[model samples]
Target: MEAEKKVIIVRFSGELSIKPDAEKYQAIERLCKQISLRLSEKNVFIDITHFHDRFQIKVSEQEVQSVCAVLDRSFGVGNYSLVDFQCSSKEEQILRLVPNYQDQFSGAEFRVRVKRSGQHSYSSMDLEKKAGAILGKTAKVNLSFPQKVLHIEVINEEAFLYSEKRKGPGGLPPHKRERALVLMSGGFDSAVAAWMLMKRGVCVDYLFCNMGGKSTERQTLQIAKVLSDLWNPDPIAKFISLDFTDSIEDIKKHSSLTYRQILLKCKMYEAASNVSKILGCYAIVTGEALGQVSSQSLQNLRAIDLSTRVSVLRPCIGMDKQEIIKKAYEIGTGVLSAKVLELCGITQGKAVRKANPSKTDEYLQSLDQSLIEKAIQERTEILLKDVDGKMLQSEYLFVDEISEGYEVIDCRTQKEFSQWHYAGARNLSLRELLANLKSLNKKKKYVLYCSFGTQTPVAAEIMQQSGFQAYAFKGGIGKLRSLQK
Candidate 1:
């Protein structure tokens, strides 16, 4: 007459099981804490007990589905199942429960799988045979390949019976390893790189060097938040943003034309290293893949490494671009990353394929190191969980085309606008637009365009913050002109 007991069994990854006793204990404790946090958000409470290689969560039957979702996305969880639990492993008690699953065995071939731990009166094979015989009344037995698998677990004085097993993310628990800083660009590669490191038990924070102003910073932070809220269980994930526009400009002005791309990477590395040191991160993680870009070439990467004191870790170094993209989609960052435009086009001419370390260092020295240092010093840090939709509202401040009744504003200089501008587009330089903001009609929908589509996003974001409906034309004037044709 006792109520049927339902529990969720979670098997920890093999990696965690192989750790030293003390490390294993700590890892399990952290994993449990993480699970509790994730479940608490959904109003599901659980009583957890750890076994040798797995853990059991006692929850109501109604909460099993929600808990299963948490386990599926959580790192360090190998697999999980919802099972009926009995306090006693007595053969008669298990036999009584066997008939309850007859409906599952009907019209299918099934085999019983028994796994035993601790001192048990019956062997696993004996239990499997007994259970299969009971299930065989309604189903045919197929040892090699069964359409249905009824699993049983015996430990000491308890028994668990289940018919379904779900796979988990299957990696070491997060925060067990040293912390690292991911140089996130709000792109597919960097976001996936962070997830890969987290899967390996590394606690990762993000460092965003903002080259495209506030809009880029906001978008990047949004992407980092997605990774943290979904994959990372640790509450200490921090996102640091530094405006690198000045440092990039410095490189453009003084650095060699051919070495601009490499030099810019070196500057980013230097900033990341400094920030990593301050934050106590052991390494700087990047999304660089060999030959994926001009600056990511092997020689350029090596030369760029010379600029930073901290070690660099590229999780995506050997991964194909398509492979990385697929993973990005799997980890829930692909859609967000796809919206982020590439803003690091510093290379004006053909960049050096194999950069010379000495020359790269010399060019790096010619620029103002103070700019990089100053940006690092003035960087803003936010816990990933604190990021909200208001911060990411700028993502809506972009339009790909000019539609009917939409007023287009060209944010170029007078001479540039006079030479060639969109038909019926009002010419309002960035400075003039800002100066006349109060006089413009608030009810009209406005679209702004600059030379390369980078600057107008900032303007559009500012306008959005001021309660105006505005958007920046994507791809700048070039794409807009193409669309016109």
Candidate 2:
């Protein structure tokens, strides 16, 4: 005999259900399109039928697990279940199906749950009591807590029997809200912030300011791609990258020592605002939490806001650092984000805790605006869903672990290396490495690491252009220690 066919039942989120009828319809349609696209990408295909409160998808038993995984990552899906059997809503039909489940429920505590939507001779309570008694013959019935739950849903003239319900991300569908641009840093904070906005129905595109050259850009893209392919429901999300080396240099030369960090932040805000206009984004999203860092203090944030005409949205403003990291891991960006090193080399001395708005604006006005405009004009835009691991790996600029037989170079000061260094690592300052590049063996692979993972990439790129195999260790010293442990 052929195996019984299975179907997936998807319940819409409560937020989506409360929208106007037209909006609710559009949201459901968008959700269905998202599901179809995601499954098609995975080579799974199915037909979806929409009901008043749920969607039913017919799939073979083999497709059920994969389909459920897609639903779990999909927004606007409240919960889903795999239907084991279906029959007429009559009490007798349901009772007959109940016997089929006894073998699995035997020796375990089980409970019967019934949800009815249409007029019937029997109410949900009546059906639950009857189903529970039948299953109790083989298993113990625990109303409070059961190891197994037998679910029965009666809609009109049909009944669906399922074992357990799996949860989804549970929010409104993507593109249901206005589009916004996110300042992505490929760290736990920005990634989780972008996810929060995506969960709330906002369509998000990323704007990455290149501070650490190709390594940073590649790592950031990898992180953004995860968010795009896994969390985002819309495929139109773009990753916009712009080189900011010259801009940072300009700020360093002209800005006050204490104000450079704040000035650099303002410059980013200005760039994001300019790009947001061209992209038609109503607001700019940031991962900044209040007082998380000196530049993120309420006063400093207020000063940063002064540089942008576009509205700035801080979804993570009230969240603690631990909370943000937890959410990042939950959304699948934690591992990738952890690989990103913080680029704070531009700031010298103590950064201003409460930057004066006038001073920030004055310093920002002194920098060359032409360079910012030029970077914007020459920026690279990528449709994120089209990106894959092979494409990202083509850069060959970063490594998570140092393989045996590879020469490890510690690109920190002699004093710092003496304090602590990776085992079997040679202490070579960046200048010394570049100076001795010609004498180094081209036949062997070299891994370079610095305190912050900033200079190693630049050095690695130079070595690569000179015909040497080189890579910067990802996440700098902090991540290196974790790997060792």
lDDT by residue for model 1 (1-485), tens: 74554788899888888999999999899889989988896678889999988999988775666576678678999888888546478877887888888997897998899888888677889988888888898899999999999888888888888888878898888774579999999999999889999998899989998888887787788778767766774677899998988988888898778999888888888888888888889999999998898888878888999888888999999998999988986776665677688687788779898999999988887899689878977888998666644455546878887899999898865645765678999998765676689999999999998655555666687788788899988765557767888
Residue-pair clashes per prediction, in order, are 0, 0
Among residues 3 or more apart in sequence or in different chains, the pairs in candidate 2 whose N, CA or C atoms overlap within 3 Å are: none
Q: Model 2: per-residue lDDT, tens digit, 198-264?
A: 8888899899999898888988987787677667736678899999989989999998889988888
Q: What is the total number of backbone clashes in candidate 1?
A: 0
Top lDDT hit: 2
- Regions of candidate 2 where Cα sits further than 4 Å from its true position: 1-4, 103-110, 138-147, 395-485
Residue pair clashes in candidate 1? none
Error of 1 at 225 (Å): 0.6
Candidate 1, position 286, lDDT: 94
Q: What is the lDDT of residue 121 in candidate 1?
A: 77
